[model samples]
Target: MVSFKFIHTADLHLDSQFKGISGLSDGIRSFLRESTFTSLDRLVELAVSEQVDFMVISGDVYDAQDSSLQAQLRFYEALDRLGKHGIGVYVIHGNHDPLDSPRMKTGKREHVHVFGPEFEQVTAYRRQDQRAAAVIGGISYPTAKVIENTSLRFQRDKDNSLFHIALLHANIDGDPAHETYSPCTQQDLIASGYDYWALGHIHKRQILHELPHIVYPGNIQGRSIRETGVKGCYVVQVAEDGGVNMRFHDLDTVRWFHETIPIDSIAGEEAFQTQVEERMQEISRECPGKMSIVRFVLTGRGSLHEKLEEGRIAVELLHELHRRAIRSASEPSGLAGLVWVESFDVRSGPWIDREALLKEDSFLGELLRYGQQAREDMTTRAEVLRSALNPLMANRELRMLLNETDDEECAGWLRRAEEMAVLLLAGEGGGESTDED
Candidate 1:
């Protein structure tokens, strides 16, 4: 029986979409971009601390057409640390880091083995005293497009060749959410006869199978709101009796969180603050030391809707929380040390400008009725409402045709389109003439 462990992670995406770092301070943004290395360093630290036999990086080491020299050097430096500790490293290029790219170069290391585009059958043995070892077979993305399933390429292990593990970077059977690169199915993976499958490409952590374990470790850190929450890798422990237990290890340098707090009876900003604090308190307890940048969405209907819908309140709240935390030195150290509120979108059912709406025959009331009627006029409301507000659509004939619309059923149609048009006009400049400008 051989008792050993390994770390699995993918999609590091070093230096991805750096242009959007404008909101962060120059130093902080630079740190965040370079923090991919920091996450990897944490992985290395974990490996050494745990005395893991090896580490496997599935793919996407960098997110660019060309990997930077600094990136390469930094990667090797981390690997060099692992080497000193006698930990082995195995890497395979995925869709983002294809084998044919000039950005990636093959190098030799006593503690490292990188699979090529072709199936490379290899085995990692337990320390010399152990009687058995695990066999791993894998391939890399040759070019960008791998239309056929790559699982068919993996050959079953020879008799008595130890536990078989297959590593590859591709989507398994058309996940619409992921890029269609080297699409293979779970059935294909099971049929391949590998004891385990280490996958990459999808940023979300998922387990596709358990019979012969198939898993994606997810990205090491959340890059944006799209890739939210506590990011990390997996720690796989293979027991002496051959039972494999996988645990997720949070290795992110920064944290991204999205939370929806229901405001059924919120009275004011104090209520909002209380709700937000309660949510943050819970997240802090759950994620501990993660630098939680949050989107505290106030959901449901309540009296506090109008105030929240106003300008910059969410940003102000986030900034204030961050300031308060820093000033009082009351932050949770387990987090990565930043709390930014990304956005506060309003979805409450409360009506805006209620007092104006109660005033009969008032402009606000008339507009409200018009909106409700327009929305209800499912048939011609879209076009009629568009023509009504858009001065550019002010062909006198069309406006007259639109103005003739008087049915109360058309309220919903007008409301929806008018609201959309209001937003469009506000951003692009009001009316058809301004749109042309």
Candidate 2:
């Protein structure tokens, strides 16, 4: 039985900075731009060492609009490196890098064969001991927005004689919140005659099927907070007997990790600091990688409410997290390759308030209740707004605006809503002034 391995990956989003609220420093800016490429370099090394037969880059090699000439050149160089070792690279353009986009460029790598905009079929021939084996079929995004179902193209390939495989990019009910790219259903993939389907566009790694073979290698690297955890690729092996095995490799230069440090039973700042330090240690233990960028989320109900209420305490906690990160970096601790604390988020809420808040007639109490209700309803005000606006924001332009705007813009929207409420209240002739009411 001839066993061969191939690396499957997508959504590099190279040369894009982390979409952080705060401004990025020079170091981080460079890190963000170079990290994905670095990870790809590592992936190539791993593939060569592992003697992978071929590599499949499902899609999104760069950020949608910001793919640069240099990035293209560097990508070609990596492909050429693989080609030098007799490794063939098969690829298809994803939503971010559709076929018609002039900005996207493919370097001069004869060994690399990228599928065009249309749903094309290509046969991969392996000649061993005068015997030939073939795997056929691949798909691509024709335009930026593909509303129609694309998986229909793969259905006929299911029962083909040669081992059939499909390379596709879509948001398969896996993430309903994401833009409905190619709007495919899982059932379509299952019914397809193809033995394996290599998917892209979703940035989180997942395996959908084992019987007829369906897999998403996920993004090569996580570009922002929205894309988290150990970002990487997949290695799939197909044997002559039609047996398949799949495995994922973490190739991120800087790992983005979300850690929830519960402040439930914690006390003073000293104890808090200890708890945080211990939590950091635990994270390092869990993800033993290089240059880890963490978002430490202080959660749960506890005495932290009072401490967190004090702005100084909050600031101190942030400083302390950085301090611990620095110390961990300087010393040879279990942090291993942990490099920085990209940012820290504290989702703290007041469990107890002034007696006035409990009184329904009290204004301060009403405000507190409203705020708590919003929090209780959704994790954060942003989440609430996202849910409320999701339907309207389904429009690409509106979604882009929402993604680019911040809390200030959201506040303006809230103010407009409040004004409308006030006008309605006045029309009802409630006779109570907003100030007095």
Give the candidate number with the greatest TM-score. Answer: 2
Over the stretch 1-437, how does candidate 2's per-residue lDDT look in tens digits? 35566788888776766666343445445656788788889889988887777787888887668777877777888888888887778888878877776674444566778888777787654422323344646777777888788888765544456667788888887474467888777788888777788888877788887878778877777766667787888887788787988888889877777778777777777887687667666766666765666676666657665566455765766666666555655565534555455555655543433353345454444544565555455346667676779897769987887787655446545544433333343335432325554
lDDT of 1 by residue, 38-95 (tens): 7878888888888777788888887657477777777888889988977777888887
CA lDDT of each candidate? 0.71, 0.69
Which pairs of residues clash in candidate 2, taking residues 3 or more apart in a chain or in different chains?
A: 158-193, 158-194, 159-193, 290-337, 291-337, 357-365
Question: Which stretches of model 1 miss by more than 4 angstroms?
Answer: 1-3, 17-22, 104-107, 128-132, 281-288, 310-312, 315-337, 351-437
Per-candidate TM-score against the hidden true structure: 0.74, 0.78
Per-residue lDDT value at 79 in model 2: 86
What are the per-model C-alpha RMSD values against the true structure?
A: 10.1, 7.0
Q: Which 10 consecutive residues of model 1 have the lowest summed lDDT?
A: 428-437
Error of 2 at 186 (Å): 1.0
Q: How far out, in Å, is residue 94 in model 2? A: 1.0
